[model samples]
Target chain A: MNLYYRGYLLGDVRRFPHWSEPSDAAGAEDAALADETIVYLRDDFSVVRSPVGADQGVLWDAMTPQWREFCDTVLRFRPPRESADGPA
Target chain B: MDRPDLGEQERGQAVGLPYIVQGGGENLADRLAEDRAAIRDRLRTDGAVLLRGFDVGGTDGFAEAVRALSGELLPYEERSSPRETIKGRVYSSTEYPPHEEIFFHNENSYQQSWPMTLYFHCVQPPAAHGATPLVDTRRVLAAIDPAVVQEFSRRRWMVVRNFHPDFGLPWQQVFGVADRAEVLKLCGDRDIDAEWRSPDQLRTTSIRDAVHVHPDTGEPVWFNHIAVFHMSTLSADLRDGLRELFPEPDLPANSYYGDGGVIPDDVLAHVRDCYRSAATRFDYRRDDVLVIDNMLTAHGREPFSPPRRVAVAMAEPTDAGARP
Candidate 1:
């Protein structure tokens, strides 16, 4: 299944990636190492952990530290259920 | 298609053929009768019929041919865009792409008085891609519910005109109205109505529902959104969203709002599904002319590679009046 940013429709996402290196690197000497360390996401998400073929740009941009922090906070503070049985 | 009743004098005579030599023609009366009879039958049953070998002499001969057969000058104002001077509208698939699906609709549906008959001549055929598709509005209308038909007859529809100003040419200039009163004046006060937004733009006004009954045959016709509202271009976002909401609406990209605006989400979804499940398509070939009752049928183009060229001629009976 595909994931959406906010409440966007599934088809709206052009690309998605899995993992990546830190956004900032020390100097020019570490540029090559940073590039190699990054992991990308695939559109189909079949190989979620493989990082064999994923969109590098999407992984780097959409999944920034800020976005991750947002996701973390939302997960930690879940809203109370309206009903015990669940919404009708 | 055989008629043994044709007399010997009419056997070899060309009835609808415009370029056929007439000086030594066998019996003009019999040939004319045959031609008229054929046209009448086609109109009554199929809503349209073709006059094969009507005239192939040459493009220059087209005007003369039309004058002799219909006893009227071709409307110079109705020529296709860019070449208004040309006497006939050209339709060719080789020049245009098939991606632009023309909506199924009656010709001049927006006009107060539409032509009674329309004729097309194919000058060239596409290599593999273009085909003209048409749907009998009458057939569609006959199959729907009566309440739906009543709903349409009660409303005033809108058509937004967005064509560029000064487009028609020296013979005729493109003009638009802004309100129902002006629309009535432009259309000669036929029951058909419109509302203009700008000098060169307008909207459909006073439209019937998606289903209506033909005044002549009393046969129910599916003369609704598929023909009138569906012949326009819309934004990709709105189009996709509407399609998603109404997965089966079969909404083509062209259909849009009366103000030339995006249709509302809920309304779009509702109409899209209704059309998707009920509409049928037929392919048209080069030189294959289809005669249809403007009130009973809706015509649309299937998207093809450009430049799509199709020539059309409209014929109105002497007494039909200018009311579509």
Candidate 2:
């Protein structure tokens, strides 16, 4: 899923299994990102980005905390729309 | 999912793929009336918006929500795939078999007039893999080889369709009329050329410019049914059977150059590839209402297991007035 603020791509939280502590986003098991400033949300619920021009950064995990937070916060503010025509 | 219990909420707009907005409950209709302007702005910027987890009252509320955002709803004219009407202006999504993928195209892009906006409400999501795939037409235009785009722009595009008593949708069902003279009049008014090869067989042809300028945004969009209706886009088995049974012009459906010449197979493939490359797809959840700016985005269905129900409605009739 992509996260957008004012129609522009903000960093998004996505899930893919990783083999080890992420050296870089490219070296992570997920499909590589090209030269993006890779940010990692470690299991401790803290956010960290790889050093500038650094080759590697270790990440314990990016977990349910960020995902749940984004969803709850956005929905609380945004207040989604609705449709009828429920199941027959 | 654990979210902190806050005393109150901050209000603003943010977008996701399809730009999800949530939290309308029993007062969905009123909330819709209040937020309609915001929703319209989001749709224009995002191309699509998915409204999730709301009561929406019922079918009446659905129509109310649509009316709040887009003034009037439209009937599905110039029909292609089979669909059943659900309520006054609501319809079941195209009634193709579960296993067939409906390729990406803007709704009614082949017609002289089309809906500027589309609304889809998921009643029941499929057992598996029944996503509505989307492609931004602007991205499709950017990805195509300029040479192919130039050719299509210069020549425009043509769609030829054959209707027979025993095969596909007959003239009556396709035209929503039984009178021959009425059909001819409809064709003439719509700029479609109609010919009768036999008492029961009819062929109609339409030439349309392949590119369109977005009415509000003023951006050129690669919009049409060119790749979608081209013969080469069909599955090989179906293609072989149809080709063996009928000549090109007599096939159930096909697309060509504006002057009635064949579009190259490779060119069609490239067009399809461009659409696929820019495509984004998502699974449906019940009560998820997806609103789309039709001209800016192309949508299609994925083959599914079974029991998928999505209700659709079109609004804001827009005529692409300049015919080729």
Q: Provide the lDDT at B194 for model 1.
A: 42
How high is the lDDT of residue B118 in model 2? 95
The top-ranked prediction according to DockQ is 2
Q: What do the candidate models score in CA lDDT, each in turn?
A: 0.37, 0.69
The top-ranked prediction according to TM-score is 2
lDDT of 1 at B273: 26
Model 1 chain B lowest lDDT segment of ten: B14-23
Task: Tell me, per candidate, how large a share of the native contacts it keeps.
Answer: 0.00, 0.02
Native-vs-model 2 lDDT?
0.69
For all the predictions, what are the DockQ values? 0.01, 0.06
Across B198-261, the per-residue lDDT of candidate 2 in tens digits comes to 8888889998989998888777788899887887887787789999989876899999999878
* TM-score to native of every candidate shown: 0.49, 0.76
lDDT of 1 by residue, B189-237 (tens): 5443444445544333333234444555665555534333443233365
